[model samples]
Target: MINDNVFNGTFQNLSQKNMPFEQVFLNILQFMEKDPTGNFKLMFGTDSQVYSRETKFITGIVIQQERKGVWACFRKVILPRKMENLHERISYETTLTEEVVSLFTEDKKEQLIQIVLPNIYKGASLTIEGHIDIGSGERNKTRIFVKEMISRMNSIGLKAKIKPDSFVASCYANRFTK
Candidate 1:
């Protein structure tokens, strides 16, 4: 189960209502089943925006079904006070993404692995990608942590991504960070 309340947002064809993480996750599973032949990529990531009074963190879960469109849900957390350093801030963002991925790939995997579904999840492999907010773009200060962050994720057996390739963090999750 997810740790925070999920906001389906414009994705999932649901209204902007908060729901239990488990229910939201289960709903996603059922939704994916609607198209058995669709190629789905599940990505998890987090992004943060620092304000004078607080830091807003948005963790997003994206299910991209190629050609069929996307379904996403996000959870937000606000911490009092801002992080002054870029490295530390990026680390925090990556950690949050890792945490959310862990909740699904490790925790929920064990809990839901028993469900005999017709999808690849039943007897095939399901790869989870972790998207980081750090980018290698020249104007981006977070580039320095790119290698370190990607290494951290790889060491945990999770494929890492950043910037342009990390739409889950840079685009989807970022949109809700405000």
Candidate 2:
């Protein structure tokens, strides 16, 4: 139920629509259960677009089992008015990502862990990441806020990724923001 109303309490993917967050969590579990021996990455990120009157933000949740398969979904949040401040927009995106991450509670995290725990000796594992749609390159305007955003993710104990590596935000979620 984490930030349930943010996306109107539903998420849509390739084959599903209006799926509740609980359902999405179950879907991730089922996907991992099918291949418990594989390495997994549970990632969350957000991207936004400002139209003339409102701003639309898309947050993507992805569970990828290394080279095997992936199950993903995204939620959208629309503001009543445009958000033109760069810092505000970027911070809000990170906050949205944090809300998604909060949905994976300790018990839920342990459930995902249990799936690969048995295969740990061999190589199975799970790593959660928060992808920020910003880069450190001098020419990138978002670079200025990279550290602040990464710090926010780290404060929540999530590994943070940016720019070229942050496909969840820069790529997946970005696709729906337009």
Candidate 3:
């Protein structure tokens, strides 16, 4: 129930169209330009289209909430022209938890395509299309979620890139100077 009102504003990066996983990830990451803190969780999908012999990738972000009740937000993509403070301070924390990476699982990836992607495209809004189901409490759910996250990470060799991070740090360090 978070960010649902503005969810339609977000859309997939056009450059990642029909690209391989490596390129897709690279492009999507840049397209996101997300603050590197506990601000958000990213979700993406690569959908195959046989007719054009291409794959389309769509990426969406859900804001991480810290309120008493569970909450998530789909943040609308802000057009660059609308950005009044490009040099504003953004979170620099790079620490990622298992739950963070697990959000990139295959199923979640697919769901992004089937469910979230269309919603994002329809109206230029960032929308969270799901509910927080904590009916049973966080006792066992947290543990189980962690286990599944670990398994998903094992399934996909996900890790931070030392080379790319350095390059981006250097490049974007001056992006807002103008």
- Scored by lDDT, the top model is 2
Among all windows of ten consecutive residues in candidate 3, which has the lowest summed lDDT?
86-95
Give me the runs in candidate 1 sitting further than 4 Å from their true place. Answer: 1-16, 105-107, 110-126
Which lDDT tens digits does candidate 2 get at residues 29-142?
A: 999999888999999999999999989999999999999989999999988779999999999999989988888899999999999999988889999999999999989999
TM-scores for all candidates: the values are 0.79, 0.95, 0.21
Error of 1 at 12 (Å): 10
* Model 2 worst lDDT window (10 residues): 1-10
Model 3 quality (TM-score): 0.21
Q: Which pairs of residues have clashing backbones in candidate 2?
A: none
Q: Rank the candidates by TM-score, best first.
A: 2, 1, 3
lDDT of candidate 1 over 85-161, digit per residue (tens): 88887888778777666556565664333332355653433456789988898889888899999998887767898
* 1 versus 3: better lDDT goes to: 1
Cα lDDT tens digits for candidate 3, 1-178: 2133322433222232233334434443443333222222332111111113221111222233212111211212222223222111111011112223344567645543343344443332222222111112355332233333333334444322222222212222112121
Local error of candidate 3 at 11, Å? Answer: 3.2
lDDT for each of the candidates? 0.71, 0.92, 0.27
Off by over 4 Å in 3: 15-89, 92-102, 106-158, 161-178
